[model samples]
Structures are given as C-alpha cells and as structure tokens.
Target: MPTFKKNQSSTPKINKDNLNMAADAFKESLVNIRNSKTLHYIQRQRKKISENRSASEKYTEFVKKGQDKPRLRDADAPKTLQERGSETVNRFVKYVKHHRKPRDERAVRHINPKHLLWVLGGICLVLIILSGVNERFRAPFRDAASIVVVPIQKGINSIGLWLSDRIEAGKTLAQLEEDNKKLKEQVENLTMTVTSLRQKELELNRLQELFQISEQYTEYDMVAAHVIAKDSNKWFSTFTIDKGTNQGILKDMNVIASGGLVGIVIDAGPNYSTVRSIIDDESYVSSQFEDTSELCMLKGSLTLMEQNLLEFTDVSADVMISLNSALITSHVSSTYLPGILIGYVVDYQLDANDLTQSGHIKPVVDFADLQEVLIITKLKETSD
Candidate 1:
C-alpha cells in the first residue's frame, strides 16, 4: 500500500472548510441543474470550463516533472494495467540500452569447463616440452625414483647373481665329490690287488730257491723235470716225469727224493719218463743199516704190508732193528751210490736165509709228495 504523504506547504483547516463550502456550492449547483433546463445548461458549461482548466493544470504539472504530455486523444491506451505499465517498461529498456550492465555478470557463450581445462593443459604441456629441450629440466618422478628405487634394483640383481653362482658351485662340488668317491674306490681295489701280487711273488721266490738247492748235485747230472702225469690208481706207486732218454734219463735210473732215494725210473720215452716207487711190486733197492754194517735188500710186497710201505727181506731173524734207524745204500748195490742217504728203517727183519721174519719198513721219503728229484747217472754197465 502506498502511504500518502502530506504536502507541508498546504493550508490545513482553512483548506478543509473551503473544500466543504465548495462541496455545498457544487450541491446547490446540481440542484439548480435539476430544477431548470436553462440553469442546467449554464451549470454544465461552467463544469466543462472547470474540467478544461484541470486538464491544463495536470498537463502543466507533467511538463514541470520532465514527463511526456498526456494526450487526451490517446487516453484509451492507458486503460489496462499492462498497457499502463508499458511506458515504464519502455523507459527502463531505453535506459539499459544507453547504460550497459556490469561485464562481470554478463554471459558470453556456451561454456564447457572440461574442454577449457584440456585446452589449458595442452598449452602448459607445450611450454613444458619446449623447456625440456634445454636438457636441464627433468621429470620429477624420474628423479624421485632414482633417489629411492635404483639401489633396491641393484641389490636384487646382485642377490640373483649370488644365488645362481651358489647353485652352480653346489652342483660342481657334488659332481667332484662323486668323482672323488669313485677314484677312491678304484685306488683301494688296486692297492689290494698289488698286495696280493707281492705275496705271490714272495712265494715264487721261495720255490726258485728250493729249485736252486735241489740242483746242487751236479755229479749225478740232475735235470729239472715237471711232473706231467699222475697215476690215479697207483697214486703212491707210479708217476710220470717230463724228462726222458732224450734228456739223458734212462730206465732203472735212481730217482732220489729231496733227502734220499725215493724210487727208480722205469718206463722211458723220448720226452717223458715214468718212475716206480719203492712201494710198488717188482721194485728193489739194496739198503744197509745206518748204525751198523749189516746189509739188507728193500723189496716190495703189497700183500704183506699196507699201502705206502715196503719190506727189507733176508735179514737174520734174531737181529734187532731200531724203529727209526737210518737206512742207506750198501756197497753191494751195483746201480746206485754206495752211501747216498735212502731213508730210516721203521721195521725190519733178520734171517738165516729162510728163518728171517719180515715186517713193514716205513720210508722217510714221502713218495706221494715228491715234486722234483735227481736222477743218478753213474752206475754199473750191464754185465754180458
């Protein structure tokens, strides 16, 4: 609501009394207008004159306030409120046209903030690239990584190399150890074989020495002969030697044992010879007592004695003989030495040609164990 402000310059109570008087006068004038037509005409003409004067006064007031003059002919345009508001709206539009609004609050075009940001970033990147061409401006991220991550990478690389080297070394060590084990086993086996070979060499040396001592009898012309064959049925009675008539060995040659006479060479060939032991039939050797001068003859009698024994026949039956008396060759032996050692007489006999009792005579020479021998070469020729 618009409050009407009093115009202080106006007369207060007098103006009010004058207004009442004018109103009363206007009422009288209206009554007169109602009473007579000529009076009414006269009153209307005065009222018209008063309205023209009021119009003139209002037009003068608009002119004094710098407002457009109200034309009575155009009064119908200000009838509606929209029409009445047009003059004020037109005046405001004209003021805006002459004086522009502040530029800060004004719209320019349709804006895309994201696209603007991209354009601005592109410009900054171009500037940065141009600056990087100087070879001085580096990426900040690269500098930071060099400060924090380079040492770690180097450590990882070193650890990988170390582990790889260790693995290779371990494999090499294992292979070497295995090779060493094999070499050790080979060396041990070789050492054992060497020891066994040395022992065999010692045994062969002993056999050679024995062979040398057995060869000392050069007078009899003893020859080295290997035992080639053995008679299985007459194991202790016969055996074959590799030496024969071709080697100066003959039939009935004396075959001496390691200590004394053992048998006689009987069968002879070009390259082989057979020996009949004293324990066999048809074998004989003249023997004498070692302690006395009594003479005897060795005879083979398998029926009278057991295996590996012989007999001294035709002795005096009452004569005594020792159990281990040494017996040897007598001077009466024409084919053998007169005093070459034969063996000990274990049992014997003495006789007066037919009354002598005979028993077994264990020979000192073990005929079955003879490996080598000496053949006597000096003997009487066969008498014609």
Candidate 2:
C-alpha cells in the first residue's frame, strides 16, 4: 500500500476509432496553421525568393536534378545565389515601367461639367478664328481631307439620287395604274350609252314608219303591234304578235309592215295573236295586176320564198302583164282588203291549156327581218 506500482493491465487498447480521432485532431491543427499569419508570410517569402532567382540558376538546378536539357543563358556565367538574385532583381527593375497615379475620384467630382464644355468651346472658337484669319493654314489640310472624303460624299449623294428616282418611278407607276383603271371604267360606260342610244333610235324609226302607214290607210282602223315570237326555221312562215281580240284584232285580219302585206291573223287570244305570213306554204291570195286588172291566184312555196318569190297562176292569156308590173290583193279576196299590195310580176308563161298563164312574183315585203306590223281591224268579208 505504501509503494504504488504502474497499472499496465489498466491501460486502454488503441483501435481504428482512436486512430481516426487522432487523425482528425492532426488535420484540424494543420488547417489552423495554414490560416495563421506567420504561415502566410512564410509562403509569400518563399514565392519572392523563387521569383528573384535568375533563369540560368533555375535551368542549372533543373539539370542537376536529371531533367531535360535547359535553354542557354545569355547572361554572365553562373554566380552565387545571392549575387544572381540581386542581379535578377536589378534587371527586372530596369525593365519595370512606372505608371502615373489615377486621378482621385473625389477631385474629379469637384470639376463642373459646364467648365469642360466652355473649354472645349474656347478651343473650337480659336480653331475657327485661325481658319478665318488664314486660309492658307487650313488649305493643305482641307485638300488632304477632301482627297479622302470627296469620293465618299459623292457616293452618298448618288445613292440618295438613285433612291429618289426609284421613289418617283414607283409613284408614277401607281398613278398610271389608277388612271388606266379609270379609263377602263369610262370606256365601258361609253359603250353602254352608245348601245342604248342606238336601240332608241331604231325604235323611233320603226314608229315613224308605222305612222306613215296609218296615214296611207286613213279609212281603216289599225292597231300597231310588234312581232313577239317566231320559229327560227320558219322566220316568215308564222309568228305571234303582241295584240289580240282585246285590241279589236280578229281572225283573217290583214297584217302589213312598211312595204306591203305581211300575213293574216289566223288565231286570236285575249292578249296575243298568231299570224300566217304570205310566205307560208298554206297561204293563198287572190292577186291582180295593177295595170291590167288581170286576176291570178298566188300560192306560197318554201323554195320560192327563199328567192323572195311567190307562185302566180290562173291569169287569162288575154290579160297583158309584163315584168315589174305591180300586183295587189283583188276585191274578190275574202280575207285581204282590196288594193292591198301583194307583189310584182317576175317570170311568166302560158299554161298547158293555153287559155291561162302562170308566173312568179317577187313579194314587196322583206319578210326575213320583220319587227313591227299594223293589223287592220276591219275584216275583209265583214267590213262595209
């Protein structure tokens, strides 16, 4: 109890955990040392020493370490480290460039912007005064400047002129297009007006002809009517008129145009009537020569009508009828009024019996283009 012996068996055993804790403590001590100002200063002094070494010394040291060959040195032969470092530092200082200190921001802030502007204005005024006072002083510079700038100015001017011309051309094209449109409109309007006027003129002339026919037949009560419809193949054969019994038109009423007899009203309705023209194959008229009073029966044929002719027969051989003699409807006719124009004699020949004659007559009416006609209200058989 008086002497205490070391307790070896009580000593703790070292494991991976204890070793790890000791390594952590060592890493923390290293971090503390790296962050200390004394370590920072030592690192800076080492960097300075390395920078002060001559390139020749660095190359020699690299060669001593069994590295690659070094570049040749252009300085004096190798010297001590202190002498070489001093020489290297002195060379660096000889090439070192000293720069002026930057202007203090506080001093710059004290300067007024207006004072700088005034100074610049004074310089510009002096230049202007000098230029005015001595033309020769600026002439050389002006000429030199023009030598370089004249071509550029000319190019700019030409570009401007080209652009202006293009603009004007575009405007002119637009104007021309607008004018062309207006001209087209005017031409169309004129064409329409001309067509309308021509139609009215034709109508007026037709009415005038009808009026003259009415005057010629003063004793007959006549009604003017226009042809409404006809068969295209039989233009002069049969047609409908725009008048009927409502306007006093009756069957067998004589229809006449400007020239002479046209047809007889074969059918009548309340508003329209149908007429069988003298050119129809079924038409037969008692016709007599105006000069000789010779009576003949006129018959229609499609072939004869194509030649503007009608067949005439039953004329007595004693009756003297010559070519171009006018023929009219005879008083013996039941459907046609007396003295109505029928046709003119064309060809004549004696019949096989030798007692009568037959011939062809050219009708007075132009049956192809009949537009309007007059219907005689009085029936040939019923009229007093």
Candidate 3:
C-alpha cells in the first residue's frame, strides 16, 4: 500500500517561466565561454604555432634577426672565416629543424618590421662612427664596399644619362619639326611677296613707256586707255579698249602705242570701244617718205603680219625711195593725221605694171604684245 501511493512533492514542477529562465542562463554561459580570455590566448598561441611551422616564415625571421645586430670584424678575434661559415650553416640547419616544431619549442621569436628598420639604422650609425674613429678600418671597409657598389652606381648613372639624352633628343626633334613647318610657311609667303613685287615692277615699266609716248605727242590732246580685249589671232589687229563714248572716244579716233600708230577706234559704246589696227587685211593708209616727201600707199596684209610688216605700194617708179626710209602719214590722207610716223621702207621693186613701186615696211609697234594705248582725241580736219 506504501509503494502504490504517488508522491506529489517528490515530482519536479515544469512551467514556461522556469523553461525560459533556464534557456537564458544557458545562453549567458555560452556567451561567457566565447568571450573568455583563456580561450582567446589559446587561439592566438595556435595561430603563432602555425606561423612558426612555416619554413619560409622561419627563414624570414632568422634573416631579420641577423640584420638586427650586424657586428664589426674584430682585429683581435680568434674566429677564422671557416669557423664563421660553419657556424652560419649550422644555424641555418637548426632553424630548418625548428620550423617543423611548435612555437613554444623554437628558441627564436617573431620580430616587427619597424624594429628591423631601427636595427638597420643603428648598425649603419655604428659603422659610420667606427670608420670615423679608426682610419685603418675605414680604407679596407670603403674598398670592399666600392668593389660591389661602384659598378652598380656607375650602371645606374649611365642609364639615367641615356634616358636624359633620349628625352632631350625627342624634345629637339619636335622643336625642329615645328620650326621647319614655320619656315616652309615663311618661304611660301616670301615667294608670294616676290611674285607680287615682280608683277608691280612690270606694270610700272609699262606705265613709264606709255608716259614717254604721251610726252612725244604733246601737241595733240590724248587720252590713255588700256586694251581690254582683242581678236583670237596672235596680233593686235582688231581689238577693244577700256575707253568708250563715256570717255569721249569716238569712231575713227587714232590709237597709238609703243612709238607708232596702233589703230583707229571703229565702234564706240557706253563703256567700251573697238579698234582696227593697220595690220588688219582691210586697212590702208596714205603715206609718204619723211625725208623724200614722195607719196606712196601703205597697205595691210594678214600674211605679212606674221613678219610684223605691212606692204607699201603705188609709189611712182622714179620716186627714188631708198631702203630704211622713214614712212609717215601724209597730209593728203583723209582719215589719218599728218606726219604721224607709220613705218620704215624695205626692198622696193618695180611692180608688174611698171608704173609703181611696191615693197614691205616694218611697223614700229609690237602688235604681238599690246597693253595700253594713247587715243588722239582731235580728228583730222577736212576742208571742203
């Protein structure tokens, strides 16, 4: 009967509040375990051991320590070069063996990079001080350093010089190219200026010649004009002038250039006028020799125009005209003015009719090249 009775007090009470309190306590314990200093120390130690076990990391540490305290060679030291070399080899083998073990098992400790720099600077300072105090050690140390560093310094200097020279050469080449372009432009401008000056000079010369011709005919009222156009032929046989009725130019007005008679204005317009020179096929002039006063006829011929000559005919057979006689416009001419020099006579012979003489005469004007002219404004007066 006693075993069968349930013990209510012995059973534990279960509730939501107690379950929540228990869960809170368990979470706080886990947080404390995660943030424990002992656990952090163990993790750091494990990381250091892992790093120490690395052969490359251990070798780096060993080399860093060796550079920390560079010792000067003592003159009285009994240790020979072979002993030092064997010691270095043995120490390297020991470091290799220690790299396979844990961090606590190795004798070497990790050094900071900043400490290595300070150690290197201190060693350099010590060497400099010793070299200053001891002259005997200074020369040998300097010589040994020069043996390794001098060639490297000279090579660096040579490379720097070569680079500097290349840069200067590049700059010089660019400057030369720019200067050459500017020089070419200058040359082109100079050439154009020279050409313009030459053209102006030629124009000046032509104007001077026309001025002289104008002076020669001071007795007559004249107007200067430029030849604007001409016939398709090579000669200035039939041409047009810049002057017209607007300039008081009229038909039959005499045009002269280059020290001789050029043509007569045949048609006049408002702004332009046409002229027919003596070299044309239909042209003729009553003429006479200036020295002899013998009457003759000057006739134009296109065929003889190539030779720059006109034919003189109707000379009396007994006129006795000589070669190179000065031919002039006779006063008896109805259209032409009196005493205007026309041409010179050449090789007169008896015509087929035998009553007259015929020959060629060279005109004074160069018809092949005509530019300007003088127009005699006064027409020849005719009496009834």
Candidate 4:
C-alpha cells in the first residue's frame, strides 16, 4: 500500500482574464518582433505568404461559385501551406469516387454465355461459307462490293488522270512554244532566200528584154538601168534610175522598158537620174496609128490612169481608128524616137470641140510594176 502512492501534480486554472492577458502578451511580442530590423526579412516573407494565400483562396472561391457541387477544398475555409498536399490527395479521392460507375445488373443479365457462343459460331460459319463459295455464286457479292469500291477507285483514278493531263499539257505547251519559235525563224530565212531568187529572176527577164530592144534599135546605143525609187505621191509618174550622166545618160534621154517607151530623163546627175514617165500630168507624146497616117497626141490623165488608160487627142474625124489598133511614137515627136510602141487603142470618141477625136489607150509599158528600164542614149533631135 505504501508503494502505490501516486505523485500528484498541480494543474493551473485558466480563467477568461488570464487567457485574454496571455493573448495580449503574445500579440505585443509579435508586434515588437515585426518592428525589429532583425526580423524585417521574416516579416516580408510572411506578408508574401499571406498574399499568396489570399490569391489562392480567391481563386478557390471563384471555382466553387462556378461549380454545381463545391469541391472539398472550397467547402472548407482556407488551409495552411502544410495541409495543401493532404487537401489535394483528398480532392483526388473524391474525384475518383464521384466519376466511378457502378456495374449494371440488368446489363449482366442480358448477356448469356451460350448466346455469345452461338453468335460466334454463326459468324465463323458465315466466314467459312463465304470463303468456300464458287466464283459464280460470289459474283453478286463482288458486284455489291464494287458498287461502293468502284466509285472510290474511279475518283482516285480521275484525280490521278487530271494531274497527269495537266503535267502533259504543261510540257506540250512549252514544246509548242519552242517549235513555233523555230518555225518562225525558218520562215524568215526562207522568205529572204525567196526574195533573193525573185530578184535574180527579174534581172534575167530584164536582160532578155534589153537584148530584144537592142536588136530592134540597132542604130541607137542604150544603157541598162534599174528603177531604184519612185515618187510615193505619184507612183509611176516620176521615178529615179540607177544610171547617170557618167553612163552617157543625159537630160531628155528616152527611157524605155520591155514593152516600149517608159519616160524622158528630166534630171540627170553624175550617178543618178530622174525620169518623168508618160503617165505624168506634164508629159505629152506625139503618137499615131502604125497602119494609118492619122496623127494624135498621147497625154497622161489622172482619172484615166486608174484604168491603165491614157488620153489620145487631136485625131482627124475622117480617120477610121478602130479598137486594138497599134499606136506608136511618131517621127513628128521632138523628144521620143519614131515607131516606138506606145499602146493599143481601146475606145474612141469625138472630142469636146468635135473638131478632133479622142480615145483611151492602154500603154504597152507596165507602169504599175515598172522595175527596170533601157535608156536610149540618142535623143530624137540627135538621132539620124
């Protein structure tokens, strides 16, 4: 009994006044520490922690307001930093419990192992039958499959074809452009060759005509010249020759082409000459019929030149001038030589005065296409 005596300790009784005094003393001590420079950093850190806690609490409150069921963290008041990890674990557990689904007893009852086996057997049998079917029996099934698969195949094929065609078209277009350039160059070269050949042919023809003219006028000396330029305003009315005074060509020299008289050289220089053609408004030639003694004058007319005709005036009324009669330069001419072919008569009529007759004559010289000429060195006054 003497060994069983327990040591008794006195317990201090805490009233409301004592609790208040203790709390006041603790608060005063905390205030003093907060004001101390040594605890400044600790105070700042504690303030930052308090700000972070307020922000986190506000975010949690906002989340709770938005949700139909408040989260466990949001249901409770703000927690200390030490309790955050446990709160997160509790929230995760709650989330898992909330989303978990209970097994449906009705669904389990609906499924039968025997029924599943039968369905599996039926599927296997169908697969085996399909695999064993003959080609003829499988035709309908293949056709049905093709109805869906063929269109997709065709769409892919069409896209591929379209791409191929575009690629081919691009290549073809480039090739065509290159070919066109080559063809154009070839055409230009051929055109130049053809032009050169045509010029040579024309020169040969002129030479032949000059030989004939020489034979016809054996008494007269002639110099061959090419018509280099013509007046644009009055085409064949005035033209320049290549031959000049150096070639014995002089002023008033009779210029003739293949057919007959072409023009009279009005201006002659050392290396060039200008000829006034018969079609010029200022030109006048003494002409007459080859068979008849009837005399007339051939003159240029702008209005009649378009029809390749010249005006024939001063013909005797009694003279029976018929169509197609050969007209030539008369000996009575001052500038032109005698018997030179002028033109053939086309039509005749009485002149405006009725005292003389006039007619239309188509010149023998092709003035429209005059290219070369023969210059008769001997003038009519100087000729024998």
Candidate 5:
C-alpha cells in the first residue's frame, strides 16, 4: 500500500499571479491520473480501501471533504503590457532563430511530385556512383588505373564564380558603351561648331577686303554700310545696305565699293536700299589686270569654296596673273567707275572650259561682320 504525503501548512506562499499558475498546475496534475508516475501505488491503496468496507466508508467522507472544483481558464484573461511585450519578444526571437524561408527549389519541388521524385532519384544515383567509385578512389587502386580523374568538384565551383564575375563584367561593359556613345556625340557636335566658325571666318575676311579697297580710293564721296541680311545661296547674293535713301541714296543709282561694282539700287525705300553683291551669278563687270593692263570681263559665281574661298571669277583666261596680282575695274565698266579695287588674284587657271579661268581672289572686305562701310556717293551723283 502507498502512503499519502499531506501538505505542510507551515509553508506560506501567496502572490495572486503565482497562486493562479500554481493552482492551475495542481488542478491539471490532479485531473489527469495518466500524468502521475506513482499511479500503481495509488491504485493499490484504492484497492485496499475497497476491500475494507469500513475503510471505504472513511475514505468516502475524506474524499467528500477534500474534493474541490478544478480551476478553469478565464475567457477574458487579464495580462499586463510587460507580459504581452515579453511574449512578443520571445516569439520574434524564436522566429528569427528558426526562420527558414522556403527555397525556390523546395517550393517548386513540393508543387511537382515528379520533380521531387527526380531530385531524390538523382541524389540516390549519385550516392550509388560514389559507392561504386569508392574502391577506385583509394590510392593503390587509383595508381593501378593511372587514368585518375580527380572528380573536379572545384570545377563546378569555379564555373559558378566565373559566371558571377561575367555578370558584373557585363554591367561594366554596358556603362562603358554608354560613356563612349556620349563622348562620340559630343565630338560630332564640336566638329559641327568648328565648321560653322570656319565659314564665318571666311565671310569676315571678304568684308575686310572691301575695307582695304576703300583706303586706296580716298577721294570718292563714300560711306560704308553693313550688309544687314541676305541669302546664303548664289542665286540671291543681295542684302540691305544699312545706309539707305534717308542718306540721300536714289533709285537707278549705281552702288559700288572701293573693291568694285557692288550692284545697282533695285528699290530705294525710306530708310534702306537693297543692293546685290558681285557674288550674285547675275552680276557682271569689266575688269583690267593692273600688271598686264588687259581688259577682260569680270564675272561673279559662288562655286569657289575650298579652303576659305571667294566669289570673283576671270573672263579672260589669257590674262596674265602672278601671285598678288591686283584686279581693278576698267573705265569701260557700264555701271561702276574706273580704278575701284576688286581683289588680289593669288591663284588662277590659265586654261578654262567656258573661255574663263576659274580661280581664287582674296577679297579685302570682311563680309561676316561689317561695322563700317564706304558707299561711293559719286556713283549716285545728282544733276546740278
């Protein structure tokens, strides 16, 4: 028979929360007999009590006095903020420690039973292969077979590393390509800008030629006007002379430069008059070479642009021209007066296809930007 140990009343312990936990533990243990390690002894004692009818009568009275209602968990359980926080912290710590996210392979494999089986089968096959190769893997057997393949697992690892590096290299290559493209575009833009500047330089040189021509003929009643606006093409080399009718300019008046005949005044408006430049294909003048004193037709065309070009052409191919030969207007010129400067003939073609030599004449005027100009008032002389 088992002896029951009674609780000692001397041990005093009470904290409301501790009491609840302890009471719950006690009730749980008592209600569940399977939880008791000493169940055999408890049963023997119960059997003894049943055998003795008087003992049974005493046990019944004792059981009645001692038995109380088991503790039940409350539906509205009260917990402190600290307890809730502690629980949350514990849960988070556990979650972090054992947080194994589903691998991509695992998710796919689980979804497909065939894939899972295939992978397992492959694993088994590899194990069998390793087992079969184990005997040959030993040194003596490997030496006998002399064709020892080291079974390069490192090769696979190297391939993985190489692939990763290549990916990084590809990104670097893309960046370089972008940089190269930007640099190329910038170079093209710079080239275009340089070309435009060169054209403007040539124009300025031509306008400067006119200025030099003016210095030679100081006796003429001439005033300079800038060519304000004009067409860039050969068909319309006309522009507005800044010095207009307000400056006593008239219609049917001949406009000239110290260089040569510029054009006739097409229309003399209030403040301005349009004059065609000699560069226009329609312009033609009689010219004489100062060195040879030979008369020839001087024509203008826009074809001569190689390196910083001009627009003047020679009508007589036989007209002797050396470097720095001065070309001036003859007295026979219909529209322009005699002794006006055209330009210096630096290069010329002695032989021609259209009875005229095509050549370069460096003009005295800077045509790109002209601040000062001389218009021959004598060309527009009024009747007294």
Candidate 6:
C-alpha cells in the first residue's frame, strides 16, 4: 500500500526551454497550414466571389437606373459561377446571336473564314472567265488598276533615273580628274623637250657661224680655242684663252673671232694665254682702207667702246676716207698680219693740226660677248 502511493517528487516540471520548443512547433504548423494549396484555393474563391458580388451589384444599380442594357466584358461582368461552370460544352459551340428587330425569330449566323475564301475564289474565277470572253468586262478593272498602279510605277522609274544620273556624274568627275592629271604631266614633259630643243638650236647656229668664218680665212692655218676667263667688266676687253705656248700660241699672236680681228695675245703660259681686245684702252693697230693703201692708226678707247666704237687717229687729211669705209691691217704693221679686216670708218674729222684726221670706227668683232676665237699660228714675221 505504501509503494502504490503517487511519487510526487518524480513528476516532470515545466521549463523555459520546453515552453519555447512547444511554441516553435505550434508556429511551424501554422505556417504549413497557411502555405497549403487548399488554403490558397479557398482564398482565390473568396476573392472571385467578392469580385462577382461587386459586378452584380453594379449591374443591379444600372438596372435600377432604367437605362438600356450596358455593355460589359465577360470577365468584368460575369454571370453566376454555377451557371458558367455548368455549360462547359457550350463554349465549343458556335454562338448565334438573335436579332431583336423584325427578324427576331431568325438567328444571325457569323461568316466562316473558309466559306468566305471559297466565295471570293469563285467570284474571281467568274471575273477572269468573263474578262477573257469580252473586252468590256476587263476595261473597267484595268483602268481602275492603272489609275493607282501607273503613278507608282512612274515614281519608281523617276527615282531609278535620278540615282543613275548621280552615279554617272560621279564617274564623269573622276574620269575628268584623271585626264587633267595626265594632261599636266604631258605639259611638263613638253616644256622640258622644248627647252632642250632651244639649247640645241642655239648651239647649231653658233657652229654654223664658226664654219663660215673658217671658210672666210682659208689661207691662214688657224687654231680654234674657247675663252676661259675674262675681266670682271661686262665686255671681254681682256680675256684668257685655253691656249698657250704648248699650242703654239705666243705673246703678240693675232686672235680672230666670228667677225674679224679680236685681239692679240698679251701674255702666254704653258696652258693658257691672255689677249687684249681692240676695245682695250691701251690697244693700237696699224691699219688702212681695204681699197686704198692710205695708213691709219686704230686706237682703243674704253669710253667710245661703250657705243660699240673705237678711235681712228693719225689719218692723213688728204686721205679719201668716208663713212662705212672698210679698214684693214696694213702690211707695215709689226705685229698684225697684212690685209686682215679691222673695222669700218663710221665718222671722221680733220684734226686741230690740219695735217691729220681722227674719227670713230665701229669694230667688226663683238668684244662684249666672245666665246670662241681663232689664232693664226703663222706670226706676222713668219708670214713676211
């Protein structure tokens, strides 16, 4: 009997840990219940019912206002849920609307797409047949189509032509630019060729003149030489030739050019020789008229040579010298060869002494520009 008594001390006591575990289990059960599909379906049903109730309320209000039936979408103004679900097979059936007019008993049938296509094809076939049989049947259709199609076709053609013209213009411009470049190159080449030809022509003319001079003095053995240097002045009054004692050129040797007597060598080296021209102030030559043996003294004057003239003094007053009289070296000259032309008498005047005359003479040689000259190898002494 004592053992059977309840053990009060062994009874389990409640604690915070146990209470917290019980609370967590209760909250997890609540979350699971809330997330269940059945609960979500119930919520959706409640929302749909509310929406339907509001739509019905709106419809009732509209009816109470005594207005004609208001237009409403099926989703916005649905009928009773039971009625909508009961007619599942009805959704697949074609709907026939009954007209409220005089033909209320007849149902208005909608047009089927397949039937409409068939009808259009039949009509087109009939038109094609009739157009082939008669011109009148096709005329109206063709004219009507052209009224729209012709303008469109013409517009397209105009655009095509404009684009083609632009392309052609661009091509033409490129072609012209190329041609212009070629033309410029051709012009440059032509200019160079003409310049070279001009130089050659000048050389040819100079050689011709030298040839003629050589013919004029065929009696003397002459050596051709080029002028190598000259004084700084414009005239070749004193110039060096590329000939000296090595070439049988000696001091006092006579020099001649294209016209006549040029000068006499004043200094001679082994390779070069200097000549003082007739225009030199210190130059003097015994001379006489070509036709007459009357002697005259030809003198150089720098001042008168400016006018391409020299001085002729010591001429006897009785001499028959006139303008343009030919003057030549006299045989009595110690240095110059005999009968060599010097110049022409351009002017003369009786000297103050009344025994002699003086005048200006234009020399045959151009001392201002001398390029080539001839040296008679035979000296005046040897010639004598």
lDDT of 1 by residue, 1-384 (tens): 223334589655434444445545655656645557566566556665555444335445545665665676476557778876897799899898656734433565445788889999998897689656753343443356444654464456457667867887777777989989999999999999999999997887798797875532335556766555567764246877667666888777787777677777766665567788777776778878878757888887656335567778766666677778877877677666667677666665444466775556667677656666677765544454
Q: In model 4, what lDDT does residue 158 have?
A: 58
Candidate 1 local lDDT, residue 340 = 67
Q: Could you tell me the lDDT of residue 357 within candidate 3?
A: 89
Please provide, for model 4 over 239-270, each residue's C-alpha lDDT reduced to its tens digit, 9 standing for 90 to 100. 77666766888888888888688889987765
Q: Write the per-residue lDDT of candidate 6 for residues 1-384, one digit (tens) a residue.
A: 112233478885544444445444543555567556556655455455455344445446645665665665554544888766655446544232211222422335456779989999999999999977865675565455445544464456457667867887777777989999999999999999999999997897799797865533347888898776678775447976766667898778899987588889876665567789888888899998887788888888778878989898887888877789889988788998888888888889999999999998888888777778999887777455
| Candidate 5: residue 225 lDDT (0-100) | 64
lDDT of 3 at 26: 41
Misplaced by over 4 Å in model 3 are 1-218, 233-236
Candidate 2 local lDDT, 61-171, one digit each (tens):
655665654554744555689987888898787656222322442377778999999999998898899978864555555455445644464456457667867887777
Q: lDDT of each model, Cα atoms only?
A: 0.67, 0.76, 0.76, 0.75, 0.60, 0.74
- Compared with the true structure, model 5 gives a TM-score of 0.37
Against the correct fold, how does model 4 do in TM-score?
A: 0.43
TM for every model, in the order presented, reads 0.39, 0.43, 0.43, 0.43, 0.37, 0.42
Candidate 4 stretches greater than 4 Å from native: 1-218, 382-384
lDDT tens digits, residues 1-384, model 3? 112233477885544444445544543554567656556565566466655344445445655775666455555443888988887899899988756765654445566678889999999998889867864544554455445644464466457667867887777777989999999999999999999999997897799798865433337889998676668765447987766667898778888897798878876665567799998988988989999999888888888988889999998888888899899888898878888888887678899998998999999999888878899998887895
- Cα error, residue 175 of model 1, in Å, equals 41
lDDT of 5 by residue, 2-117 (tens): 23333477665443444445534544555568745456555445455455344435545556765764444365333898877887798899887555543432465457788778
For model 3, what is the error of residue 169's alpha carbon versus the real structure, in angstroms, after optimal superposition?
42
**lDDT (C-alpha) at residue 59 in model 3:** 47
lDDT of 2 at 15: 46
